[model samples]
Target: MDVKKVLIAVDNSTCSEKAARVGYETALQFGAEVALVNIVEPVPANVNPDLTLAPVFLETYDNSKENSDMLLKEIELKFAQGTKTTYLSTVDTAAHGIIKQAEEWAADLIVIGTYGRTGLYHFLMGSVAEHVARKSACPVLIIPNKWEED
Candidate 1:
C-alpha cells in the first residue's frame, strides 16, 4: 500500500523516542507527511483526596501539556526535515486519542512505542501499542523498547 501519510504517537519515555525515530525513518522512506501526536491523560481523581487541592491538579495538568508540547517540538525539529509535519496534543487515553487522530488525519500508517509489558504488569497497565494496533483503521507499527542492533 502507498503510505502517503504517517501518524506518530509519542510520550515522555525512551521507548517513545525510539518509536519517533523509526516513524521518521519510515516516513522518509515513503516520502510521507507526518503528524506527531502526544496524549496527556488526565490524572486519576483518587490521587488527590482533598477537594481543596484542585488548583494543584490544574497546575500539574498545565505543566504536563507544556512539557508535551516541548517534547513534540523537539521531535519535529529533529526528524521532520523535508516533510510536512503537524504537532498535536490531546487529553484522553493515549491509544484512543492516537487512533482518533489517525482517522481524522487520514493517516495511512501509525507508529507507536511499546514498553513490552506482559502478565501482571500488562494486566494492570494496559498496553497502548497493543490497543492502537488492534483498533486503528490504518496499519500500526509498534517499536519495542529494546531493538536489535544493526
Candidate 2:
C-alpha cells in the first residue's frame, strides 16, 4: 500500500519514545509525511458535567494541552527532524482521540506504543494501542516496551 501519510501517536513515556523512533524510521523508509498526535483525556463525566465549565476544569485542561503540545514538539525534534510533520493534540479518550485524528487526517498508517499492562491493570485501564489497531481504518504498527533490550 502507498503510505503517503503516517500518524505517530505518542505520550510522555519511554514506550512512546521507542515508538517515536520506530515510527520515524518507518516514515523515512516509506518517504511518507508524518503527524505526531498526543491525547489528553478530558475530565470524566462522573466528575460533574457542570464542573466542565468551572475554572478548575479549564485550568486543568489548559495545563494538559500545554503539556501535550510540548511532548509532541519534543518528539518531533528528536525523531522526525527535517521531515514534513504536523502536531495534533486533542482532549478526548486516548483511543478515541487517536482514532479521530487518524481518520480526520486520512492517515495511511498509524504507529503507537503500548505499556503492556496486563492482568487487572489491563482490565481496568484497557489498551489504547489495541483499540486503535482494531478501530483504525488504515494499518497500525504497535511498538512494545522492550526496556531490557534497549
**Best-fitting candidate, scored by TM-score:** 2
Please give the CA lDDT of all the candidate structures: 0.88, 0.90
| Residue 125 of model 2, lDDT score | 82
Residue 88, candidate 2: Cα error in Å is 0.4
Error of 1 at 15 (Å): 1.1
- Please give, for residues 1-150, the per-residue lDDT of candidate 1 as tens digits: 899999999997888888888999999999998999999997864345664546767788899899989999999887777678898888888888999889988999999989898999999989999989999889999999997536
| Global local distance difference test of model 1 | 0.88
C-alpha root-mean-square deviation, candidate 1:
3.0
Native RMSD of candidate 2 (Å)? 2.5
Cα lDDT of model 2 by residue, 8-106, tens digit: 999989999998998898899999999999999887433456644667787888899999899988998898868899999998889999999999999
Compared with the true structure, model 2 gives a TM-score of 0.90
Tell me, what's the RMSD of every candidate?
3.0, 2.5
Candidate 2 wrong stretches, greater than 4 Å: 44-52, 147-150
